[model samples]
Target: MSLGDEHDGQTRTRLPEGNTGDPYATPRRPARGSRSLIAVVGVVALLIAAIALANRGSDTPTGGSDTTGGAGAPARSAAPTAASGVRPVTGKNGEIPTGYARDEQGAQSAATNYAVALGSVDMFQRGPREAIVRAIHDPAVTDGLVKRLDDSYSAAFLANVGLTPEGLAPSGLTFVSRTIPVGAKVKDFTNDTATVEVWCTGLVGLAGEGSTKPVTSTWFTITEKLRWTGGDWKITGSEQTEGPTPVNGDNRASMADDIAKAVEGYGGFTYAR
Candidate 1:
């Protein structure tokens, strides 16, 4: 699904703040016997799943980076030019693929990346979100999203996460919701329409101390049915479903101090395809 999140500063988060708190969690107790056996099975499953996804990505011809520059020009690009935001860093959607997104794979990639961008932490900001929605979504969907997003960030909603009418935390809290598109493919494509599923694994939670909303993660598949309009793909209708996801690994959770440090030290990415 096109999951969304925000920082402590903005009031434009996708869902009401209440829905974000204690987000979509379930118990995960290791199976009774044969812990090592279970671990082995899980690791193997993850490896298999990763291989499959990598194959899909490799099969799909994606957008390429075209850099025309004088020496030391910083590439004239604000975002990284990769299909999956180059591994860790920050993982979310970037500006709509400008060129090279012409064919079916390109269309699918553009749609997937657009979805990830639309459902990103930047949407919590006013100027960026409006610009993004206007640029990516068909005109019809834009108005609805604007109005609905306004409501979703209403005073009542913001109150859930201890925000004021302006959707701001008391002092030091940071809201966090970011989606990382693992891979995407178009099940079907046509001149004027396409059905693409962007399988995304993402992190969602609050940053900063004493924040009610803790950072969490989720796996979902955002199936977007798009219509080609104005020379680009736009979402006509979309829905999310349970992921074709693998189980989480047994790595120890990062310490809270580390989490805070990472949040401050690291930066977000610009996704492409």
Candidate 2:
């Protein structure tokens, strides 16, 4: 079964007050002249100039770099939605991504993709499940982790989830368990270790006519503590928790056949952060 189904400021600079007469002279009846007005206008102009400068800085093209504290310089902290520009890794260990860059972005990318692999339908099976565990987990824990996962996908557990002892769905049904990561964030990072949280939505169940377990969607977050091992990011530990779920929509649910067909027709993605 998919893990998703189970687990789940600002400083202000003071502007100069307009040059008023000396404090003693200020006691003279407020000047009727435009000195006060001029000061006000000057202040307004300065504010407008400051605002314009800020706007220009915000509008600078992201591709340009300004090393001299110019408008074109990138912000010290990137906007949350800004892309990392890291491409998806080209290497695959049995369809799981490998060879992640040794950086925070790479850690996030590995955590996201590893979550997908661990929550996959293949995890309900034996051979593919073992392969997945070995590929994504750190070498120090691979053997023990594989054994633990094997026990978790026991024959009775498979049967409970509407799968056969061998992890197959009944003749007419398609078993679906897929996790799609919505986004990833780094919780902590260092040169050799990183902790990432992957928010994901998944579907897990049997899809077909008269299937006892109709495919349903779930939302959850998977937190993976990863270590840089053997020149790549590998999961050292992981946890899942229930979602930041959205309110259910009013759209009608699709039929079993349609859901089954869609599952077969659509392909899952390889995620990057």
Off by over 4 Å in 1: 1-97, 162-164, 270-273
TM-score of each: 0.61, 0.71
Instruction: State which candidate has the highest TM-score.
Output: 2
Stretches of candidate 2 off by over 4 Å are: 1-85
lDDT of 1 by residue, 41-146 (tens): 1011111111122222222332334457777655333222332321111212234343324345445556555655555545544566567666666677777766
Q: Tens-digit lDDT track for model 2 on 1-273? A: 111111111111112122110000001112234222111110111111111212222223122232557777755543343544445464777667687777666777788777767666676678987787788878888887666656655676566556789988889998776666777777888889988887777666678999766666756677788999988889777655557778889989999999899878776666666
Worst 10 residues of 2 by lDDT: 19-28
What is the lDDT for 34 in model 1?
Answer: 24
lDDT value for candidate 2? 0.59
